[model samples]
Target: MRQRNFRVRSTVVAAVMVFSTVALAQPAAPLPATGNLQPETRAAQALPSLAPLVESVKSAVVNVEVVAKVSSSRGGMGDSPLDRFFGGGRGGSRENVRQGAGSGFIVDPKGLVLTNNHVVEDAVSISVKLDDGRSFPAEILGRDPLTDVAVIKLKGKVEGLPVVGLGDSDAVKVGDWVLAIGNPFGLASSVSLGILSAKARNIEAGPYDDFLQTDAAINPGNSGGPLFNMKGEVIGINTAIVGGGTGIGFSVPSNLVKALVPMLEKEGAVTRGYLGIQIQDLTADLGKALNLPVTEGAIINDVTSGSPSAKAGLKLDDVVVAIDGQKVGSANALTRVVALKRPGTVSTLTLYRNGNKQDLKVTLGTRPDIEGIGKRTPRETEESSKARVGVSLSDLDARTAQQAGFTRNEGGALITDVVPGSPAERADLAPGMLVVEANRKPIRSAEELAAAIKATPSGGTLLLRVLAPGANSRFLRALKVP
Candidate 1:
């Protein structure tokens, strides 16, 4: 139950997709030099219907069906995109088989289809159905779980397949007309219309989560589908939707897809260049604390010993402003740039160190395993007899904070455990969560938290400012004392 709080721009449940951590190469066609793409031209006559466009592009869309062995206790194909919509995020004990379905589109004429990793990952058998009612078995060419993108080849494809045009996602702006084509709720090839609601959204799905959000009616079966612009170009791959929420859906930008497909097809895995540094977006508080004149870069929190940064003389608290002359606005930007390049690439980094600007040449190394980051550890079960609010609280220690992925400066009481069906669970508090503030007051220990709870009025709603490890930001929650 690892979840990153992307509470409306802030909630995402972190799904651990087991895959190779290596990064592959980007496509040969580089991104456009600028965000200034030519505006789409359209006819002046009012179009009567979208029938012509749908007829032209619908054949490129596809429905994907998969069957795999799963735990009988869990009852179905593991955590699927549709699982969020259908309420099925559980696994079982006995070995059993399950079925799942989603959508995709042909990217190459020779049957190169693109879909989500979650759709066909761990699948024992896969079948794809074209819009023209032709079904064929599909073979996975490669899968990059990190990006939620997978490349599958449709077997027995008699040449001459229709391909959806890939569009520039950077050129896509809010309020643009968009159409989502997919199988929603098992509805095959269903089309929904909406406007681009947002862009470059970090749904906290992954570090490179530059998603295109739309108000389209994307539902359970819509995962791995295509999001198209009015010009009938595929701009996004529909991936996620807010459960039970109206008009909120997200797609992986097609530009990322275009960049990833070539590598996935070639290497069958992706490799990321690692700098061996933990970083965060420079905050005004950090800027003031560090005596900095500006707060516009990524601040190095820690540099791993014996890693590339250590060898490159990179230090803790170094603010990385640019890499290879490209501006790095935040931690994610730096991460995206570094991760996309191959290992052994020497990159020049402009850094602000102790209020002094400097440049360092760093040869990027392979990023090691990050899958264990923020994983839960066995807590010391030293407990008090009394329980207030049915929550077990412990003093935040360095070990607890590190295991929870919190920075060294973060101080708080740790929610060690939550009793089932209790107020803590109702308030969405869980183990490994740092309770930084209670009732708007900073709490340093369990004793302080108890005092704060005692200070609250009886049956009053207790306001909590909580920071979960690996989360982008702190969030507010309220619990009514019972």
Candidate 2:
């Protein structure tokens, strides 16, 4: 019996060896290389006539021409239709004319195009011209003024349309090769190539702004055009030009579009979560006072009453380290993360409180239409102006603050106003909130505040003991009086 078992085992081992030999002889083909150099070599070997991805995406680019019909109290002077008929007609009348030209690109085969909001703002008529010399009347899908992004749709039958692919803008590093495709000075199909000069640049174009700085020769007509990477993926939307800088331009990153496009397509506008908390970057002095390990994250300067932050128990001087899983490296990063989230969405905010990490759940609310909410009253303005600081001030008033979706009642003198190109604006004194004190002194009237400010010597450091009702309540801040 033992001899029979040994023969069977030997026979089984021999069969396995034969199978293994066959498997080794028939090896599978090697995986295609993902490296660009190897791929290029293979492509050259396969077909040397093939062009780069830019050639494929070029056909999708288009020119946008917008015409706005404006009705004004001040109308065209002389030769007015009313004046020619009645000989005493008023000059004020409504007239219509073409505004300007910009660039856009088709993102979908169904004729959906993306452009800048300011490009087609208030336009009664919008025409899109394709590279193939076809013209179509386009309708606006949505316009987000804050981000300056607009989506438009072509009405007629559009066929054989090429679409531009969106690339991850976050993946693009400085000094990466990029291409700008747009119509400058009505010149169609113009392309310029350059390197990405910078990324995550704050240009102060709007409240939620992080521009992609490039030296790709973008001009006036390049607004809303595509800024493509070497791989032919659209990484950004060309937006603005820098002052006195040759070949220096800016583009809105594609990540913004990834967040906004779906909302615009479905709802015609983007909705963002609002907390109404003013934040400031942590300074060296602030870090020292807070005893922080590092000067990172957003420090809550003030929280609006009844705001999402206040309801979430966010305290004054609490350093926000992360929001909804994304790290808040700066105030701008936090703002961008919040702006991407929809109102009514609950987000987990990680905060550093007394040198401890804690996460709080904050349900966001709808943001207010700040443009519609007018400035504060004369009395409110007069009172805030009295705050003896270097800044001009005004109040957010009970009504204005409420309408603006503020839930705090500790409202005092809101910095309703700031002079342009002034020290106040530069110091980031915005148009909202309550000011409780000036130069560490409690201020009951705007007159007293103004007196304190006037008494303060120029270039002196001033301390303010403030009561910010929301996230930052009873906070002490110091500012340099320029």
Identify the candidate with maximal lDDT. Answer: 1
The lDDT of each candidate is 0.74, 0.70
lDDT of 1 by residue, 1-482 (tens): 11111122212123334677544685467655343444432332334587778888989999988654343356533443333322343554643334667789998988889888777665545689988888877767777767788888877635778898899998988999899898765678899998999988887787778888899887666778899998899999888776545568889898888888887787765777999999999988988998888877899989899999999999988999999999888898899889888899999999998899889999999976576332111111112212335577877788877877877746788887665445577799888788889888887887887777766653468899998877868999897553
- Top candidate when judged by TM-score against the true structure: 1
User: Per-residue lDDT for 237 in model 2?
Assistant: 89
TM-score for candidate 1, residues paired by index: 0.65
Q: Model 1, 450: alpha-carbon shift in Å?
A: 62
TM-score of each: 0.65, 0.63
lDDT of 2 by residue, 262-283 (tens): 8887777777779889999876
Residue 386 error for model 1, in Å?
53
Provide the global lDDT of candidate 2 against the true structure: 0.70
In Å, residue 280's CA in model 2 sits off its true spot by: 0.8
